[model samples]
Target: MAKTIFITGASKGFGRIWAEAFLKRGDRVVATARNTETLKDLVKQYGSTVLALALDVNDRAQCFAAIKKAKEHFGTIDVVINNAGYGLFGSIEETSEKEARDQIETNVFGLLWVTQAALPVMRAQGHGHIVQISSVLGMVTLPVLGLYNASKWAVEGLSETLAAEVKDFGIKVSLVEPNGFSTDWAGPSSLHTQPLDAYNKVKSDFQAGLTDDIFGIPEATTDAILKLVDSANPPLRLFLGKMALPWVTQVYSDRLATWGEWKEVAEKAHGK
Candidate 1:
């Protein structure tokens, strides 16, 4: 059965890929971007199947209004892909307070606003899926993009809690954690803080070690997304990419080791 998919940041990147995939499979798409004009090609290609809406996710009113329009246009949103976010690239100390706040507002709060706006409609309909486009950074830490990591980590926590809260309401939630995909997330879409000389060595080493092969193919990621969406028992968190599993596995193993290594001390601190 063809479904109605509501995707944010559908102008480009993974969001656009997902929109194309769903449309190709005969689904209706309510695509949104800050500049709705960017979505014209989708409307041209898919015709009435696509409804491009103007949305600046950071603005609460715009978020709610866009969702309202989506509901009005499509009757109900079957699945929502919150894929609108930019990375903040810089060391923790180098990133200004303003930069950090702006990153959180767009990446975290924006997602929340859209979800909040969609929930009522979903609840009324009694079935929906909310997909959050988080990153591998959400589970594991990265050096230069700590702020970006923090934002995704927030998404992870929120989605996890939300999944439990909404299960009884026939609403499903999933966090798609992609290992670095071949996107402009670290390039044009990123906000770079003024370089701090103190962290030159760390920055240089991290940048030098980067490789294109680390990125997963976008098409493969989209295929995985389609599979997840079709699943009656979708995972609370699904990691994409070859490195995603290994890296996330390491994060857990390290955490478990740390906990076991410090078990006595941990229990003492808890007054157990």
Candidate 2:
């Protein structure tokens, strides 16, 4: 059966790639972007199967309105891909108030608003899947991306709790945590803060680590996403690249070791 999918940030990157994949497979898509002009190709190519809408996810009203319109147009939205966020590049100390707040606004609050809007429709239909495009940074961290890391961490926490809350309504939540991908996520779509001399070495090392070998091709993920949405039982979290597991495993192991080492101190803090 063909499903109706609502995807944000469909102008390019993973959102556009997945939208095209779904349309190719006969799924109806309500695709949105801040600039509808960028989505014209999808509309032209897919015609009636694709509905392109202009949306700025940071606007709460636009988020609600877009979802409502999609529900009305598609009759039922089987899946929602909240992929409309960008990365913020900067160290914690170097980040400005505006930069931090804007990051939160789009990556955190925007997703929350969209999720809130979809809950009502999904509850009424009694079945829907919501996929959040988080990052490996959600589970681990990298230097010079503290704000982006914080945003994904917020997304991870939010989506996990949502999965538990909406299970009774037949609404599913999944966080697609991708490792480095050859998407404009790190290019034109991202925002960077002014660098401080104190952190030049950190920034340089971070840039040095961005070798072509680390990034997976963006289009290669379409099959994985399709399978995820098609599954009768989907995972609460899905990592989308080779490096995600090893990176997360190492981080978690270190975390566990430290916690174990301080188990007595932790218990003492919990005083009877």
Candidate 3:
């Protein structure tokens, strides 16, 4: 059965590749971006199968409108991929209040708004999938990428709870945690070096190391996404890339170690 997929941030990066991958597999894709004009070529190539919508995920109204439009055009969305997000790199102390709020608004709250709007439609249809394009940062925190990590962690928590809440309704939520992929996600659009004297000693080298331009191709992530979409029973979390596996394993091990070391203190502090 050919399913209809609604993907945000479809103008570029993993979102764009995922859109193409679904289209290639004969699935209808309702691709959205802040600037729909950028998807002109895809729209032309896929014709009616690719319904391109102009959507700013940060805007609640836009998120609602996009969902309604997608439902109208595609009849019912079998999958909703919330892939619209950007990275914010800086020490939490160095990041401005406004910048922090903006990061949460786009990367965290925007995803919430989209999911809120899509859930009703999916529930009505009886079965659907929600795929969150997260990152390995969601599992582990690094030095300068605190803001980005926080956003992804927020998504991870939200998606985990959402999965349980909607499973009875036949809605499946999956988090796609890709390692660094070669995309504009690490380019100029990526927030970096907020210029704090406190961070000067650590900022330059950290920023250089954090650049994701040299990572695996976007196609690899897309392939993982497709497999997840087609699986008989998909996992709640799909960690993509060989490089990502080690980091994820380390994160789990580190967390367990920390918990074990602090177990006595934690129990006492909690009055247990």
Candidate 4:
């Protein structure tokens, strides 16, 4: 059965690919970006099947308005992909409070608001899917990507809790944890790097390590997302790309080993 799908950040990157994939599979797509002009070509190509809306997920009013517009156009939104986000790369100490807060606003609160706006419609319909575009950083924290990791970690927790809350209503929540994908995500749109004299020695090495050349293609993530959307029973968390699998596995194993080593002290501190 063809369904109506609404995706955020569909101007480019994984979101764009996801929108196109769904369209190819005969689904109606309500794709949105802050600037709808970027999607003019997509609108021209797909015509009535693709409804392009201008939205900034960070704006609560716009979030609700966008959902309303999508629903008005498609009747119902079968899936909602929260893929509008960016990264902030800098040491925790070097990153200002404003930058950290903005990261949370865009990556965490933005999704929260959009999900909240969509929940009522899904509940009324008694069925829907919410897909969160998280990252491997959600599972493991790297040195300079603290704010980005924190935002994704919040999404992981939120998605888990939401899954339990909405499952009874036939609504499913999923997190897409993709490893570095070749997207403009790491380009000029990325948050400006904050430098501090105290960390100068290690900053260069860290900057080099964070470059985008190491990422794989964005299509890997889009493929995983399509599979999840089409599955009769999709996973709560879908890890994308060959790199994401091993990296996530290793992070979980290492965290488990470290936790086991500290279990005794941790339990005692918790009064267990």
Distance (Å) between predicted and true CA of 243, model 2?
0.4
How does each model score on lDDT?
0.92, 0.94, 0.88, 0.89
Q: All candidates' TM-scores?
A: 0.98, 0.99, 0.94, 0.94
The prediction achieving the highest TM-score against the true structure is: 2
* True lDDT of residue 135, candidate 3: 90
**Across residues 1-272, which tens digit of lDDT does each residue of candidate 3 receive?**
89999999999888899999999989999999989889999988989889999999999999999999999988998999999999887888888988899999999999999999999999999999999988988987777788888999999999999999999998999998888877788786687645788787677777677655537877766667888888768899988877788887887998899999999999899875
Question: Which has the greatest lDDT?
Answer: 2
Which of the two candidates, 2 or 4, achieves a greater TM-score against the reference?
Answer: 2
Per-residue alpha-carbon lDDT of candidate 1 for residues 163-230, written as tens digits (9 for 90 to 100) = 99999999999999898888887789888999999999999988887897887778787779999999
Q: Show where candidate 3 strays beyond 4 Å.
A: 207-214, 270-272
39, model 2: CA deviation in Å? Answer: 1.0
| Structure candidate 3, residue pairs in collision | none
Tens-digit per-residue lDDT, 1-272, candidate 4: 99999899999998899899888888999999999999998889888999999999989999999999999888998999999999897888888989989999999999999999999999999999999999988987777788999999999999999999999999999998887877888786698666888877666887677665558887766666777998878899888776778877788899899999999999899874
Show where candidate 2 strays beyond 4 Å. none
Pitting candidate 2 against candidate 3, the one with the higher lDDT is: 2
| Better by TM-score, candidate 3 or 2 | 2
Cα distance off (Å), candidate 1, residue 218: 1.2
| Alpha-carbon RMSD to native, per candidate | 0.9, 0.7, 1.8, 1.7
